[model samples]
Target: MANRLLEVSDLEVAYGDVRALWGVSIHVEAGSVVAIVGANGAGKTTLLRAISGLLPVRRGTIALGGASLAGPAPEAIARMGIAHVPEGRGLFRQMTVLENLELGAFQPKARANMRQALDKAYALFPRLKERAGQKAGSLSGGEQQMLAIARATMSDPKLLILDEPSIGLSPLVVQQMFSLIETLHRQGVTILLVEQNIHQALKIADYAFVLKTGEIAMQGTGAELIADPEIQKAYMGVLEL
Candidate 1:
């Protein structure tokens, strides 16, 4: 528990009258990959939004590096070592790829490391360097996803939170994307990923949680969850005789 880089306990969030998350608790250990998988509208996005301080928490708590993130603004959260790549690959469309990455290091600490971070990102994603001058909106889907992840690294985040990194990609591209995620973990990055690609997510995750209708349905080591008959039946469309 003390080693957890990101912790959310009994987290509840809502959008006006509608509740999106209900008492969801999850934790990511330092330098490990943890994943949350759920169907659409199952409160996965709400949970990430609350953790990143983009949405207000109606109840519960989010803590990073053992400090509470109760009411900090989104930018404050980013400076405190959390980088969120929300769904839809939120990018500055008209900006050049290099420019988009530059914006990620706007924080004082991040700015200090901007050059090093840019170099590091380019190292991890060589294609980004190849297309550094291209407009972000003109990039292909896989390239755009790479830019999103690369830009998040520009902040020098302690906890990198990714939402649906595998959506809308070819199988080969998805494999490549997962390889980058795996590489990030191998090089000492703590990640909390939300993905609909259940098989690949579990395959790469150290731990996995299943969310349904605003609640955590199951939590276990990725292998444990993957082997569970109920999980296989529901998420993987497996049938038991």
Candidate 2:
């Protein structure tokens, strides 16, 4: 059996008096891609926020490699090997691409290996190397997304969490984004992804969870879910004639 790298058990989260997630549970295995798919209001992003410690958990537990992630701040969480590339591709707008990437390795361990990490990042996204000196805000949408993923990799995370990575990109660029994600997985980064592109997400995932109104509505292997008739109609846009 594959070792679980990250686990969320019976999680409940709220914003003030309003509950956003209820009894949500999921796990990502080492070196595997796990996807969460759902409609916009299904609380997918809320789940990511809670896992990354951006939001406080109202109830339940989140563990990383058997260690509880109950009290660490977001930056501290990054140092503990979980990098979250948020939905907006949160780059330092006025800073150069290289500078943004350098900031990603601010943690002690990652800082020591910064040079190797930069080399790897550049090799993965050569376009970034070409735009190394350019301001982050000036790059095209696709390039910015590439920089976001590359920056997250600088931390040498055990698990990478991505939120809507394909949002606002052209279809061609979206395809490239998924391909890069696959490359990252092949290079041994366990991924926990929340994507609106359900078909592509399912295609690349080893296991998947479908969220509805802040709860897991379904769970199965990627192949199993893809072949399920209900999933095909609801998520894959398949219509039986």
Candidate 3:
């Protein structure tokens, strides 16, 4: 059996009294890419936030490497080896590219190997090296996204959770972003991706889940989901009589 890197079972989350997720369960195996694809308000971000410890779980379990992640803070979750690159590509606007990357290594284990991490980060994103001194806010949309992923890797996370990595990018840039994700996977990072780009997400996913109204709607291998007529009509813009 493959090693399960991240497992979430019966996860329920809420904002005040309004529930956002209901009994959601998902697992990502080591060295595999698992995608959660859904429309807006489907609670994709809620699920990611719950796993990252940004939101309190009202029910069920979240385990990383078989250890519980119930009460830890967000930073604690990061130290536990799950790096979340949120939807907005959160980076310090006024800071230089190097500065943002350095911050990613604040964890003890990562801090110890910061230099090597920096080297690897720059190697993966040579543009970041070129703009090492440039303010993060000044970079183009695609370059900023690149820096975001590079920064997340500075922690050398066991599982990388990406929330809409392709959002707001041009079509060409979206392709490049997905290619970069593939590169990261090739380098041995297990991924749990939450995306609205169903076709692209499913194309790269080893396994996938569809979320609707904060609940699981369907699931299958990438190819299987892509070929699914229901999925095609609903998310892929295919017309069926």
Please, what is the whole-model Cα lDDT of each candidate in the order they appear? Answer: 0.91, 0.94, 0.93
- C-alpha TM-score for every candidate: 0.96, 0.97, 0.97
User: What does candidate 1's lDDT look like per residue over 124-237, in tens digits?
Assistant: 999999999999999999999999999999888899999999999999999999999999999898999999988889889999899999999999998888888888888887
Model 3 lDDT tens row, 1-241: 3588888999999899999999999999999999999999999999999999999999999999998898899988898999999999999999999999999998988999999999998888899999999999999999999999999999999999999999999999999999989998899999999999999999999999999999999999999999998999898887332
Better structure of 1 and 2 per lDDT: 2
Q: Which structure is stronger by lDDT: 1 or 3?
A: 3
> TM-score ranking from best to worst?
2, 3, 1
Clashes of 1: 0
Ranking by lDDT: 2, 3, 1
Candidate 2 local distance difference test against the native: 0.94
Clash-forming residue pairs, model 1: none
TM-score of 3: 0.97
lDDT of 3 at 33: 95
- The segments of candidate 3 whose C-alpha lies over 4 angstroms from its true place after superposition are 239-241
Query: Which candidate do you rate higher for TM-score, 1 or 2?
Result: 2
Residue 140, model 2: Cα distance from true site in angstroms: 0.5
